[model samples]
Target: MIAPVENKPEDVPPAVVDEEEAEDGEDGAPETQGAGGEGKKKKKKKKPKKKKLEQTEPPSIGLSRLFSDGNYPEGEIQDYKDDNSYRTTSEEKRYDERRMMEDIDETYNNIRKAAEAHRHARKWARKFIRPGMRMLDIADGIEDAVRTTVEANGLEAGIAFPTGLSLNHCAAHYSPNPGDTLVLGEKDVLKIDIGVHVRGRICDSAFTLSFDPTYDPLLEAVRAATDTGVREAGIDVRLGELAGYIQETMESYEVEVNGKVLPVRPIEHLSGHTIHPYQIHGKKSVLLYKNEDQTKMEEGEYFAIETFGSTGRGKVVEQGEVSHYARRADAPHVPLRLTSAQNLLKSINKNFGTLPWCDGTSSGGGEQLNHLVSQGIVQDYPPLCDVRGAMTAQFEHTILLRPTRKEVVSRGDDY
Candidate 1:
């Protein structure tokens, strides 16, 4: 709901008053006789009139203005909150109801703050990033920008997960390890997936960057698919139907590389999922291809509506060394024989909790991490890659399905 506009007393102009007054006379009475005993009229002192205040339009309170670069698609904003249309009967309750210790407005503000941090960091990264830069430097730059923008302190607010700088065939889950010497090339297609959270409310979004115009179509396809997903999504929308719309929009475009036309395909296995508090991946998954899953999106849920378009095989497989790891949310308590493993687990719990962390963020504990992985106390995520010599691009936006409207929390002008 839009707040009422109030005008302070200082904002109003003072009233102008005109009164006839005689010099040396009380209460504006004219002197009957002058010093020469002749009746004369004294010149009246005039009060300057105050000009009327100019009328200008009030500042906009639309949701689009919340972010500095927010560009939500048409009709994304609704006034259900003002009209009390968000209320529903008990029988029609959604699967996931809104649960928070604070008020709903405060919750939205927290989420928007996190989204703004992500937007500002990404904006700086997009401008500062260039070819020939090391992947490690790029990741560090983005993460550092996020930390600075959010003013993160401990777990109250910080990076939701490790920044993914997957390039070319590597579709996702690729972040550079410490001392790794992978440099970005001019021809490479880089996918930058960044996450930020405020008080456990995560805003997960990603975009693709390509230096060459030859891969423009690939980027466009993925961005269009993501936009389609965001536009088509709403309360009570079926996940399978949403997938169909995304695939239809994504597969409609083709790119030309070296005079060879290649149709962009949606990555079938890599699907977008819901985001929960302190957890990047929730239970529900949104596929890129058409399916029969009858799960309907409920109100009061946050979703990462992401899509990956590729010019290679539509499916991706795990490859390369594991760099991303996270503590299992439901990890079983198992006695560890090695003290290093126990220490590493303690560090992970204290520092990262269940959020994903990369090797770059860790402090040289490969053996202990391996031991934790063996015990299933931690889960490892290797880089996901398509076929060699292929190119993939991804675009994502986090959305909150409010009772009144769906908020594209991560919507920015860049993507």
Candidate 2:
């Protein structure tokens, strides 16, 4: 079971131990005694035994160890490894398996690095974000932090997708456009979904923020639902069964808004998904509610276990201007008449590749990009929203199904 997040302990540096010095006389000279009254002899004094320092559990791994060297700390072994069945009887098979394990370890390191970058960036966002801030500023601040921390250059390492700052009824697929003037309100519930990638290994995780106390139950419901999904997820686990657990945990809470008691409902349409290299959404989908889909999670798969809870209608519809777009991984070759649209497609391929991007990151807005969308060359993701008056909340974490055990790579001190 995944342990619940707790308050982190303060960092304490290791104590410095100084070398013991030899005893000296009052005159600052070594003590000496005459031997048989013939010549002066040096005297040795017994030195006091040094006290042993108390040992305590080491601090959990954080960005410093991740960035400096890809070594996970002692306490983080469980978070990375879950099983130990790699031993074999055949020497040849053992050699082959060792090579395979080396590749797997490298992959895990890349994913964990991205996960650490995401955790650090979002932790900063949680502290820096507040009401009355412009949506553009918030997005810039987060993306900048991720890029800076990851030292993103080209496609090697960078932001996996556009920073999602969906608010109020908006559940996902929302980010500030280039000139968007939307400002956060104190009553709005904001979902900050962040993605980071190292060499195409993406760490996709998110959390909801509400400034008002009335929505505490709503946030708690979504967070607990996400936690349930992460805990229940493992090798050979059925997606439908996992969704049932998430739904049960989510629907158990109720929030009162304006004297009206509203039961938090799981948004059935929005589901978690498996992640692939350079692909945010893989083929398999992890539903948020009970369903007939019996897809079993296999080993060596990365999944983003996310859940959405709402106080209004449990269903969400795409209802807003399109701000998010991505080049289709399987985009077919098609002829384009407009040169501007063709140029925009080239720019997207050269810059964003298969990752989702917003208008702020891409150039040639208006009909040029729309033309590409119409041609099916690009997929546009509009804001997903519930009812206008209702509020929505979401929480997400990425997990890896290793051969030995499941690793919650995106797990952090703060969720």
Alpha-carbon lDDT, every model: 0.81, 0.81
**For model 1, how big is the CA root-mean-square deviation?**
8.9
For candidate 2, what's the RMSD?
Answer: 7.7
Best by TM-score: 2
Alpha-carbon deviation at 405 in model 1, angstroms: 0.6
Q: Model 1, 389: alpha-carbon shift in Å?
A: 0.9
Q: Write model 2 residue lDDT over 184-296, tens digit each, in one string.
A: 99999999999999889899999999899999999999999998888778777889988999999999999999999999999979999999888999999989889888899
- Displacement of residue 44 (Cα, Å) in model 1 is 24
Total clashes for model 2 = 2
